[model samples]
Target: MSNKAQVLVIDDEPQIRKLLEITLESNGYEVSLAATAKEGIIIAANHPPDAIILDLGLPDESGHEVLIKLREWYINPVIILSVQSNEDDIVKALDNGANDYLVKPFRTGELLARIRSSLRIKISEENNPLITCGEMEFNLSARIVKKNNIIIKLTATEYTLISLMVKNEGKVLTHQYLLREVWGPGYINQSQYLRVFIAQLRKKIENDANHPEYIITESGVGYRFVCKE
Candidate 1:
């Protein structure tokens, strides 16, 4: 019921937790700190935060395991904070369900920016129950898509992809971004997955799959969902 967005920082390092607490609080956020993974999970389940900044290296368990468990029920953004800078580690964490990643010794400005961006999207998704554009309509709360007032069936993956694109309508979502959001960062290199899914989506929503008016491909870049505001 507090107007300010609540953030939970789950990290063992006191310095990191203090820094995050100060930064997030100064930015008008209600902050909570958990030094262990078990404590983080318990606090989260008891009082869910608007966003979470989780460290990969935890004393009790791997942050990856924690992220997986949170994603099983927690829908809010969970940004990974770690010292691992390798591409494989970044991709692995993302694939496991992290919303974003920030390496250790990170810039506070960028961290705030990522949190703001993620929270903005989450807020939109939660508040907007129905979205209309051209012949298509999305019942975001129900996870339902319809065209011309007729219900259209979609696989969970497809729905996830389309919903992401739709939520970010008119923005050209890069292949890496879409892949990270859809199949996780591990699939960032899998361009074919996007192509196949895009094709299937077009077949279902577009009047002519060959010439789609809703989902536009950026040719070597990514895809964008075009709609009238």
Candidate 2:
């Protein structure tokens, strides 16, 4: 069996597909290509990739719909690579379960970095109690969080919020979802409440609260946690 991680590229544009294939292959990944949503779904179902590069525009069906269906069973990372840069489209895709989103005309270096981040997060989800990102470390079982080997004090709500975000590193957590998970169903509409808590979490975890490195604001959406590396 090949040790290389596999990446499935689903895009209608022949040039984009070709480019991705070459780029991914040269970077030590196995590549699969699909031009339409139907074909992509079939391929993914048969041989699930370690990660997916999905385009939002497809010939047979909407890529968003394809992402929704794939999320039903495929647990691996799904990164949306779309021309649609609108906030609504980005939010919808993230809420529908995309692991990450990169607008088209993206630099290959950045795309590679996103893929690496997604793959690393997926590989780290192996029922391990300890999760480490940059200087921060989390002990899920003991409910302890540390920065640079020193324990950091956090309130109950703050710990819960940080734990949730850490567990979902590299994926966007929408305002509604974050509120519902951390606060409850009643707080789904309370974006301000979420913002305040996020700010608090950043102050505790980030090196600079004003320019946070870990908890990133998605802008008009929610937040995404990323390890600074």
Candidate 3:
């Protein structure tokens, strides 16, 4: 197999596909193009790529439907590159298992960065199971969490939230993503629930809940788990 990371670009627009092909190929990546959702799905199923750039609009089928079908078996990153700028669309895409959402007219630099970030997280998860930050340690295989070498108690929801964040450490997980993953798809709009649980989680894990170092809130966007030592 070629060492170059492969990327599938699924878009109805020929120009967009061509542009992504050039950009991705120049960045030392292998590129595949599909002009419709059906074609994209077939290509993806036949030859899985390291990552996917999916457009939300397609001629035959909605890209959201395509994403749902892909997530049934496709484990790699799928970034939404769409013209929809509304929050609901973005949230819906992320809730449907998209790794990241980037509206159309995106900066090439930012798009590349998002791809790298997604790939990095996927690789790290496959290779490592024991995650540690500061005095906190998480043994994913055992579902055990320790702080300062002492066992700590957490509610089921709290544990789920923490594990999700830790798994996506060093990446900004949007409110929609976290809510969907932890509370399910129906609760995507319930940001206050996340706030309450996050507060409780911080109290249990952080040395100082007043100034958390582990979970950093991204203001209006979401929260990120900072695990860098």
Candidate 4:
């Protein structure tokens, strides 16, 4: 059999880290544990796992901070596993470099699915060049987004949603497509999230977010990105 997938679990709470270890090990993953972001970073730089699971409430430093530090060097996917369910927390983690997250008290099944999805994204991004839309550029190769010569921060979901639309520029992706691609098929019916995140992407990418020129709505259909002039 292939070697078990490697995962680094960073959380201050022993119970949370232990649970993650148990869940991941049982699911055929080799797990590493860190109780603080400081140690987490050291462990990550030394061992560089295939993926990372981080908690927002770290004992030494915030997970967002750790994410930023790791992102400077590590391109592997970082999934935030936090109890902080607020929109601000989610946005902060994603903007700082998290690939996805799970709300606290999450199900083992859901968590497993999320890890699988993240691994898929990491593999797909390998060897892919940057993608551009309008005045904005998404450097998939660099994991950076720039607009109008300025860096615009994007949450993981927001970035995923925008990247999908831009990659399929001019094609109106139905709500199902957007939802499934970003949030996964688990939230295919949550159409309102599409509205919220599209607005976020336009505000950061468009010359006039009020009347978007990059992302367009299709009335009864879904949204599409006009990537070419």
Candidate 5:
């Protein structure tokens, strides 16, 4: 009966799989290896891991499709580790329910950090409704947001937008998803509307609107709410 956090590595590259197995095991985590999307999904379904490190390019099926299938039942974090660094692929993965994305030639330390962050967020979500990041605090139940212990005034739209981001902190929220959730299905293509509201939220919550620390822009994809602690 081992209590170590289990991490499943799903990659086609033997080298990548070996590297992750070593990195994760040495860092005190139990590891499972899979070279194909089919095998990976089966292993996950049998015994779910605390987190998953998945690659986009698979011989059997695309990792994006695999992620979609896993998200249907698996609620744990799924971090995309792939060679595809384009905005389209990144946005697609995030939209499909990946918790984080890292380029193929990534740093082991950073991957470990991402795994830790994702797992911690899972625990936090289950244990509390109050989310604190740097100088900000969000009381999900009361619908209150505070900065430096002072309540910040926010409109219904602003609060909804920020609340959505805060709830999924550390994970990228695609523009389409955010717009659809905050506004509606009709506003999914309204990127400009999202930008305006994001800017407004930053101005109210961020110490420096020009250089935001919490609501980070993911270039042409979307925004990722980071917890600065």
Candidate 6:
């Protein structure tokens, strides 16, 4: 396959490896398969695939360990392909670094769609330079966030959550969606985490954090990043 995009498929099962390789390749993506997490890491370091399709169960090192290693350095769209359907497993994968996930037996079409969405997000983010809301300015390129020209320090997770919300500014983001996208799927039930982060962000950007004019809450659902009309 050529021109679709390079994808690295890491799975310990030979049959599974062949299945994914054939599917991705036939669909026009160049695919590389690794049977072990160690090999996957080496391939990722050396080749730098455009995206990753990783199976959570590996023969040598577990997928979580591989994800941690990748998160320590690499930053690309990663989709987890796993038989582990447990909520904890999914959440752990998302929190560790996966951009998307698929449980075993996922249809080829669904997998491809997810991969495209992930890539689309990465490309869109790369193209974004700056976003402004009233006196607040968010510079994605510089990774700096400011209000009234005063720089504010946002924790890594805070920045992630803010960016996610800002990208969907003016749209009502559901609590489940926001928590899953930013923190992880397991965190959807953890509204307090979202509240704390939003409170912190509001304090830094809004004149009154308690009032929270910039980050507006939409009842019990989620929040909206207020934008100038």
What is the TM-score of candidate 6? 0.60
What candidate 6 gets wrong by more than 4 Å, as runs, is 1-3, 127-229
lDDT of candidate 2 at residue 102, scale 0 to 100: 84
- Which structure is stronger by TM-score: 3 or 4? 3
lDDT of 1 by residue, 1-229 (tens): 8799999999999999999999999999999999999999999999999999999999999999999999999999888887856556656776677777778889998688778767866766656778898989999899999999999999999999999988866544667888888999799889889889999999999999998999987554467687743
Lowest summed lDDT across 10 adjacent residues in model 1 is found at 84-93
Q: In lDDT terms, which candidate is top?
A: 5
How does model 1 fare in lDDT?
Answer: 0.86
Q: Ten consecutive residues with minimal summed lDDT in candidate 6?
A: 220-229
User: How close is each model in CA RMSD to the real structure?
Assistant: 8.2, 1.9, 4.6, 13.1, 2.1, 9.5
User: What is candidate 5's lDDT per residue for 104-175, written digit by digit as tens?
Assistant: 788987787789889887887774678788888899999999999999999999999999998888777889
Best by TM-score: 2
The residue-level lDDT of candidate 5 at 53 comes to 91
For all candidates, the clash counts are: 0, 0, 0, 0, 0, 0
Query: What are the per-residue Cα lDDT tens digits for candidate 3 across 121-190?
Result: 9888775779888899998788889999998898889989999999987667889778999999999999
How does candidate 5 fare on TM-score?
Answer: 0.89
Q: How far does residue 187 in candidate 6 sit from its true spot (Å)?
A: 10
Once fitted onto the true fold, the runs of candidate 5 whose alpha carbons sit more than 4 angstroms away are none
What is candidate 4's lDDT per residue for 124-222, written digit by digit as tens?
A: 554456766667888875668898768888887787777776655544456666788889889988988888888878878878889987787755446
Candidate 3 clashes between residue pairs 3 or more apart in a chain or in different chains: none
lDDT of each: 0.86, 0.89, 0.88, 0.78, 0.90, 0.81
lDDT of 6 by residue, 14-95 (tens): 9988999889888888999899998999999998999999888887988888988898887988888879466567667776
Once fitted onto the true fold, the runs of candidate 3 whose alpha carbons sit more than 4 angstroms away are 127-163, 170-190, 193-221, 225-229
Better of 2 and 4 by TM-score: 2
TM-score of 4: 0.58
Candidate 2 local lDDT, 97-195, one digit each (tens): 898888888999878888998998788778788988889999999999999999999999999998998887877788888899999999998888888
Better of 1 and 3 by TM-score: 3
